[model samples]
Target: MKRSWWKIACVVLLVYTVVGGLLLPVPALRQLQETIRNLYFHVCMWMAMMTVFTVSVVNSIKYLRQLDLRRDIQASEYATTGVVLGLLGYATGIIWASYTWADPNNPAYASFGSIVREPKLIGTAMALLIYFAYFVLRSSITDMDKKARVSAVYNIFAYAMLFPSIWIIPRLVPSLHPGQEGNPALNVNDVDARMRLVFYPAIIGWTLLAVWITSLNVRLAFIKEKNWLNAH
Candidate 1:
């Protein structure tokens, strides 16, 4: 595949994130220390995932209105890629939390298992499961048009569930995830000026990469669809 300028930009920005995120100075908050650098990678993954999923829902809505299989294809590819990013984000959070929140000498939790039930983690897991079920719904039915319509409706339902899970339910509980005042990711006061430079770029870069991956899948699906139609 010929690389576009945007793809090259994604590579460059990500390279900058890797180098600067490590070498750049960050706020020396107590306990968080060096591990706070996870902000660039972990938080960026989540923000990018959210952006991609939002696009997925928009595509789903288009599919619903036009009953276009191509729109459904875009929706599925973006949702799947977003889920991949969400899983990666969740994994990175666990590693960071284990180091910071579960340091044996000054543990944040009584047991390691407690980390598994983190409010933010639970919220993100719910969102991921809902989309995974979307894929399962698509696979179960043999009729293409019916499958697209039903699953597109489910996609909008999944979108409705997404925001509440990540934003509302987590806020209802006493979470160690730290959004009491407001979501740290969005709070101007919470993120340091220095971190913001790398953080925003990281979000854009990661999202472009996710979209690039989705485009590849969509192209493959388009080809497969064409071949299948010809055979029939």
Candidate 2:
């Protein structure tokens, strides 16, 4: 029961999010309409991705402080999981965009060129590429200690760059994404009071789910490493 509590919470919260998110009434606005429901799912994925990445960075920092290879594994697994969630988020965002933001009727919405040029998209891609390179770096090194130490250092540097690439640079460039000039979807007047209830839980639920997935990856990595050490 102790180990299962959070997992139970995860399932319950997500079930609520899916059921209530789809059925909940939202403020009708120009351009958004029924598509606003996607905020619960699509937006939560990105939010959860960020949360997982933050945890990965913290684990990397811990590995550096303690020189613990297990911590390094934790860092790598969490980061890889974060990247997976980010990819999923990006895919869902594209689907959502095609329906509403990319609609031909909306002057601001662009289906193709704008998507490629969008600052957020570009930055997000860059961030994912950096993390992907981390794995490549790890695999190329043969020494376990060297791999752990160098990867932990590189992880910190990559995470530092990630903040600027995904968060800062995107804000400087022109973006159709919300929060540019005060997001209406986030504004209390623009979003209904009821949506906030589901929105917050959805974020927590998605984040917890991401953490759960990361835990599985971390355990598998640990077992593989342990077996390799025993074999040698």
lDDT of each: 0.84, 0.81
Error of 2 at 99 (Å): 1.2
What lDDT score goes with residue 65 in model 2? 88
lDDT, candidate 2, 1-232, per-residue tens: 9888999999999999999999977878788888888989887887787778788889888988887788888888988988998899898888788876675775644458777677767766876888899899999999887998898888889888777566566667788877654322556665578789899889889999999998988888888889654554
Model 2 lDDT, residue 195, Cα: 89
Would you estimate the TM-scores of all the predictions? Answer: 0.90, 0.89
Q: Which stretches of candidate 2 lie above 4 Å from their native place?
A: 103-110, 181-190, 228-232
Q: Pick the candidate with the highest TM-score.
A: 1
Could you give candidate 1's per-residue lDDT for residues 1-232 as a string of tens digits? 4759899999999999999999999999898998989998998888888888899999999988887788888998899998999999988998898877785875566746667677777777887899889999999988888888898999998788777667676666676776654566788777899999988888888888898889999999988898544454
